[model samples]
Target: MTAISESGPSGFPPGYFLITSTATGRVLDVGGQAIDDGAELILWPSKEVSLVQSRRSPEADNQVFFVDDSGALCSRSSGHAIDIDHDRLVLRHRKPASFAHPFPKFSYHQELGEINVKFDGDPTRNMYILTSVPLRKPKSFIDDASQFLTTNIRTPFASLFGGVDTNSTPEQMTSAGVDLAEDEVLEEERGEEGEIDDSPDEKREIHMLTIPHQRPWNLAEKAKLRRRFEIIPLRTASKRTTGITV
Candidate 1:
């Protein structure tokens, strides 16, 4: 199996990708192309049975995923994020609840080639590693059982992104908006540039102008009225005051 990269390929943000398991050689799929909440994730054969195939496979939208800014693996078909519930992986709404944070953040581990889940900003917790196991569902939920995607294993079952698959070409990667050459050029340009200075260029004094309330304004009424104020920079105010009587 090809070693997975620690980080995603260049320009990989917001790009569609297939998460294929190294153990079973199957891709992570949403069961029944489901868009509803609590849909279980399963491992299914790839549309073309090749890791190098195009991401535009017919009826493969449920298989395509992109990492969101929050680091959640989001499904393109359901617009939901992969979440852990009762030690099982399922698709859930990405919105955060008042009591808990947003969906758990996921990071790719190069050494183990597994996707690690982080919860409540704790990394040392012996959480779970994404793995594929024989489907075990309640008889009431499903009649037939197959392979299911899970995260309740100690040993990590490595998965590879289609963009970083060894067999994938630059053109194939570019189809998902990853341009290796362009990223290389940009990286080189960044290295040649000088260090950036984040300090403010100039200091400015601020003067707030407040308008007094009318005579009829009582203390309560004054409190109710919104305060009107304007800010004047020291330099600009000084320029305006030049040649004017104080």
Candidate 2:
């Protein structure tokens, strides 16, 4: 599976992807598990599949948002927690009560995910049902996600979003997004570069990235990045405060 780049919240990779199964028409995860048999197809949330995925939660209660393969905006359920686990995009009301339904007669596909077969009382009836967008690693209730930067818990989820304020303008949001993207790219390149260094300095550069005092690990993934040729932080002046600052 492709790895998500380490960076800001946006760098967090989706735990599941939506794809179609060959035997059944249902979409599958990267592992080929059905998103759910007969999962109503929709667009992925990136605007374009190639664009970065959105990390923020649903903004509207009346709407269900999901990352359709086409990366367009669409609704899933009125308000159910849709999740992408392994290969299946499971959708159902996120409640302890809903799981009381009976099991299937065939070999249990617990790993195949909760099947939503609709039997209208006939021997093999079709139960027509629907659900909402996908959520990853669903718990009883979602909470703040901490990256656990250290064993001690000094860092918080808010740290990922430090510096910026809620009142910032659209221009600021755009600038921040650009910076995060660049940092992600640079880190990826550095990882690639670290593998093929041949010269003395190249070897030294790789070695120094792990040095303790240099604080190689101090930089946030979204901050500006530079070639850590020798345990350096990747940074640059923001145009807003570049030459105009005191």
Q: Which candidate number has the best lDDT?
A: 1
Q: Count the backbone clashes (under 3 Å) in each candidate.
A: 0, 21
lDDT of model 1 at position 121? 63
Please, what are the lDDT tens digits per residue for candidate 2 over residues 1-246?
Answer: 122232222111223222222112222221111234334232122212221124323332112233333222223334233433322234433336666332211111122222232222435333311111111232232222322222113323323667443333322333344243322232332232222222222001100011123323332332112211010111123223455631
Off by over 4 Å in 2: 1-16, 20-47, 54-91, 96-99, 102-246
Q: Cα-based RMSD of the predictions, in order? A: 28.9, 24.7
**Candidate No. with top TM-score:** 1
lDDT of 1 by residue, 42-159 (tens): 7666564323324245577787677776667788787788887764668897554675456766655544445555677654535434543322123332322211112212112222
* lDDT of candidates 1 onward, in order: 0.46, 0.26
Judge candidate 2 against the unseen true structure and give its global Cα lDDT, from 0 to 1: 0.26
In model 1, where is the ten-residue run with the lowest total lDDT?
Answer: 227-236
